[model samples]
Target: MTSDQLVAAPETALPTLRGAVAGLPSYVPGRRGTGADIAALASNESHYDPLPAAVAAVAEAAGRMNRYPDMAAVELRERLARHLGVTAEEVAVGPGSVGVLQQIITGLCDAGDEVVFAWRSFEAYPILVELAGARPVRVPLDDSEGHDLEAMAAAVTDRTKVLLLCTPNNPTGVPISHGRLEAFLQSVRSDILVVIDEAYVEYADAGSGPDSLALYRRYPNVCILRTFSKAYGLAGLRVGYAITTAAIADGLRRTALPFAVSALAQKAAIASLDAGEEMEARVSAVKQERARMAAELAAQGWTLQPSQGNFLWIRADDALLARLVDAFDHAGILVRAYPGDGVRITVADPASNNRVLRLLEAHAA
Candidate 1:
């Protein structure tokens, strides 16, 4: 029988699929260029090229493609542990921080549990929760477009299995205060896991954000998710990790897709760790550029949050945002626009930033 005809037969029992599995939506990555010569800034990525050391490491590791990667990811885990001042057992490396997140959800949450997170955060939280057959309880951000910690804590209930926290939050660029974070953690039940997604932690200024890793030490249920994708300029490498108690790390390691992290990626990440001087210099440049972009936008009467991350969140009506996006697209410049009042622009290189600013000015005029 033909493949199409066989599927049409009612007597054949269809392959069973979980309700959640069949309904799961695919994750959308940040916009990448399909056309030639587009200055894309939709995703908040580092402007500089990958470090020479990382490149060399990846190249060297390419020769070993015949063998499977270390399932335990021992050396990489050790390096990360040393970098974070944690034991190797407390660190779990995966394809990316998102993998670590998936592992955690699979290991800790069962069907019908609830996951609490602030709306307009990483966009992935709710989707991932739903894929796990868990309900996503979203708490709206405060007037400042930051997480409403008190409201989020209050949202916690007996059914809440996990609380996803994003500081210097994505798209909004607001950080939760150390005091507020501590209070929120204390208020939540000890059994509930708190996943602090700190993907942009390197770009966050020292004074504004809380020390989530320290909190992880105090709270056994807390997991700190970090990535090499942002400031490390390894977005293409797909390397990230999680830090938590040994038990949680063990669970993540057990459930994670084996060898999801390529050998080259692991080597490149280890090399990136040693490129601290270069990374710090790039971060400084990004901070300066971010400040300039926010000021330029504000001068044009656009409202912007005091961005702590490497991007600025500007507020404008939906129509205005659409017009700006269209103008930018026509001018070969790309930025992020949400359905609501949020528009995000990352601080790219000086030339790209200048071009983007000129496009915005023309559109505004």
Candidate 2:
């Protein structure tokens, strides 16, 4: 054969993506509602701007963009270690909670392995499991739209490598109780990793949310996932971390993409941690707003599932969901709607919150 024929053969066709990546459903972000008048409550982002401390930290770190971030994320991990009262070796830092979760899946699962989780929990769980070449075993949520931990336990087989529990579950806004979570933990095998995603923990009513750290202390297999994005108002900065056994943490760190967490993100997260009092105050405000919204929604003749997260859930069969979404869009308010399941409306500022309430009331009347 001629040299030209050999050289051209390699360029004739582009390599195709893996079936998993190509077949993966597109992750849809919250719609940026068209104008200033629009209330975009679709993403579950904190209603407030970044904390002053975080903003300042980001500005300071902006000048250092010329260099790569610290791959180990030593300072941030050390600070998180101090905050959580664990050794640095037990903490794993990543770009976001979802990123850390991806690392967990990669570290634990092999082709044909299985991972168990609640259906209608975090949407990313199944996708991540599939990406890792593992089979996803999803157990349906019980009638109250919360996890049926017993069913989940039954789904686990010897091949199960991971289990995920997203407390105050996304979209549904329902939290698993302390008693229930403990019981579930007791029933599960010790070697399998149980990831507790507490991304919305700060928004949960203190009395309702689980004291998961206490459980983690008791259960060596439990891995607590958290993010600076939700309550700390650092979503754009993309910083998250995990608290788990040193063995599991080491695996996560090893699987993480090098320099996944940026310097600016690290600085902002540390500053957010330092400003805990202010963060708590902001959380308190959101709780109040949630209570008010719940009361008004009930008065308007809607029976909502009890919400512990920063969002409210409305059960809408597919047909109803389409109409409701249309009406909401026309009114300049954006909410996340699950095609056949429900709608998730974030608790935002007073004006935006009131706007939503007013519209719903009008519809009911």
Q: Choose the strongest candidate by lDDT.
A: 2
Q: Please list the C-alpha lDDT of all candidates, in the order they appear.
A: 0.87, 0.91
- Clashes by residue pair, model 2: none
| lDDT per residue as tens, model 1, 10-65 | 87677998887788777666677877678888988887899899999998999988
lDDT of 2 at 102: 95
Candidate 1's C-alpha runs over 4 A off are: 1-17, 34-36, 363-365
Evaluated at residue 105, the lDDT of candidate 1 is 87
| lDDT value, candidate 2, whole model | 0.91
Error of 2 at 318 (Å): 1.1
Model 2: which ten-residue window has the lowest total lDDT? 3-12
TM-score of each: 0.94, 0.97
Candidate 1, backbone clash total: 0
Worst 10 residues of 1 by lDDT: 4-13
The parts of candidate 2 lying over 4 Å away from their true place are 1-12
